[model samples]
Target: MNDADNRPVADHPFPRFSDQELARRRRAVHDLMEEAGVGHLLVYGSDRSGSAVPWLSEWPVTREAALVITPNGDDHLLIQHYNHLPNARRVARGVEVDWAGPSTMSRVAQLLPAAADQGIGVIGPLRARDHQLLSESVGELVYLDAQYTRLRLVKSDEEIERLREAARFSDLSVAAIIDQLEPGMTERELAAIVEGSYLAEGATNHIHYFATTPMASPDTCVPAQFQSTRRIEVGDILFCEISAAYWGYAGQILRTFIIGADPTPLFVELHDVADDAYDAILSVIRPGVHARDLVNASAVIEERGFTTYDDLVHGYGGGYLPPVLGSSSRPNLPVPDLHLEQGMALVVQPNVITPDQRAGVQTGQLVVVTGSGADSLHNIDRGLGRIG
Candidate 1:
């Protein structure tokens, strides 16, 4: 049971939440716990490199990581034993924290003994660890994979604003890459420009960068760090996808460009077909649409004249997914039938290829389904990009 007041606000760049906003979200989480009959909820954040915990708390949790929230409305954040200046500051503010080993079980017990003894419903990422800890510490404990994922799915007005800002930064990055389109520049150079632009636009510290040379043989997704050193040549085609994060929110984008000459007639035809298919998926997208149906529509694009990189349509937004959920990192292609509903954001991409041609068409959009239809967060050029 801790209260994190007087938390320093100067060290971080993220805008501190207005007292109103914090109250609103806090109330929302409490309400959700009440509805689910959860006496306490524990949220475990990624401890891996580039964790989003810092972005949320304005402080890093070191090796130890887990957030405990009691139904009485107390927030306790437990972390590993470093006890650096940042950790000390947070702990001093009554953030019921303890230093423990990285073992998940050790971390779980430190955060939930009281709740477990009281027979409170506990939900989070540490059931196994909780059980182990309980066997040694006190009473039996039960936990479900309870998470705030579904609650966080719908964005609040303030959250929506931050996401839009992040998307705008990504859009700016894309435009910068397009501006640098030329035959002589290396893919690495272009990637640098994109990342530099993102930073200049106040993007958060984490970044995922990738680029592709559509005209090259055995075209493959080149990671940003290892973008082909080979210089771009005349008539080279470029495709890039970047996932950007700001204030702990993330959005993905894809854009293509052609250098030295107009895309070949064949390329133009394929691009149009791909665009149409992307729109086709968009057309069927609305509240209550079945995710599998959207996947089926994407398949039609492949059947007509395109190649799908993979069959995938998962929601994306502020929170990164857990391992079990099929996400970009651990893709379980062709996910089971999931219903599409309002407040769910998705990326619909359909890459179409011709039966006789080696080249393929690719197009996609990030959209949010509304009651009436869908709306795009960023508007892409109808004609992707032509450098000629």
Candidate 2:
């Protein structure tokens, strides 16, 4: 009865969205900003990684780029480079443009006047680059980000439908990886298969990839050994905390699997404890429940024979919208009081460690809040994932 035995079932496929749908998502952003009393929003991107900039503007902001949404409902796409100006303009349909000089943030700062004078409530908080620019230009104009995030949390029916498809694809992708898993296979090799399968199935991103041996610290990223020559071996466990985008919605899926048996007693016991934790958490999820109470309830799993890592649950949405769900952070959870409401999506992952501290195990599921309870979008087998 090792904890590793109860792995979630995986069965889904890749996801895609139509152009009209993309446009609709952007419009929704504007509408939300207006409703929140935001005079203007300055959305910026510093890196090429996951960003809400693309989600809102429909354009990827690689360099110094920002999206300005005014109270009048008008929008603007500002960038430092002239070369990407065309690409930005192409992606921005109705939004105005303000290409600025690369060396200084002054040009972009000039746009903050309306935001400062009337005290524009910012949507997405300005990043380092843009924050510095704003400090110099607008000072502090009652900046805020909660309203914008709340609007995203309660997904529209269309958005829910898209997320459902993405979850389906995530499940299928994991199953495909499981089908490809075998003893002696390197972790890197397995990751490639997992990622490749997602693409072949039509996925554009590898939301995330985490795997490792039962006794090893969780592999949360693609290791470099993948390039050399490493392979999987017996007694190994493959765990994944990944997601994908279908249309404009996001699908988050977590999975765990084991290779050739000879299971450790601790692994078996903790894996089952992890299962109980997963089920317990799932049982209490529903609309009206405060995120903190959910975490408190899940804390009992530790009392029942398991150790916990991170929070028991966290909020999730398209891209990486935050106020991460659940009451698990420094001292206590910091997210403002928000009840689990129908249409809100979440990921409940409960990782367990043995009393001895030698082994750690976990099980997590992605679910959507319903009127009564919660509906799971991800369905991976919760028993020990065994390979022949």
Best by TM-score: 2
Residue 254 miss distance in model 2 (angstroms): 1.8
Candidate 2's C-alpha runs over 4 A off are 1-38, 49-52, 80-90, 97-104, 110-115, 125-129, 214-230, 319-336
Off by over 4 Å in 1: 1-13, 31-38, 48-64, 80-108, 119-131, 138-147, 205-209, 214-218, 221-228, 320-337, 353-361, 380-382
Q: How would you encode candidate 2's per-residue C-alpha lDDT over 226-315 as one tens digit per residue? A: 333546677766556667655445577766666776566766776776677677778887888776666666655556565554445777
Provide the global lDDT of candidate 2 against the true structure. 0.61
Q: Write down the RMSD of all candidates, one decimal each.
A: 5.0, 8.8
Question: How far out, in Å, is residue 267 in model 1?
Answer: 3.0
Report how far residue 315 has shifted in candidate 1, in Å: 0.8
Pairs clashing in candidate 1?
Answer: 64-80, 305-353, 306-352, 306-353, 307-352, 307-353
Using Cα atoms with residue i matched to residue i, what is each candidate's TM-score against the true structure? 0.77, 0.78
Error of 1 at 309 (Å): 1.4
Please give, for residues 220-273, the per-residue lDDT of candidate 1 as tens digits. Answer: 422343577878777766665565667566566666566776677766766676
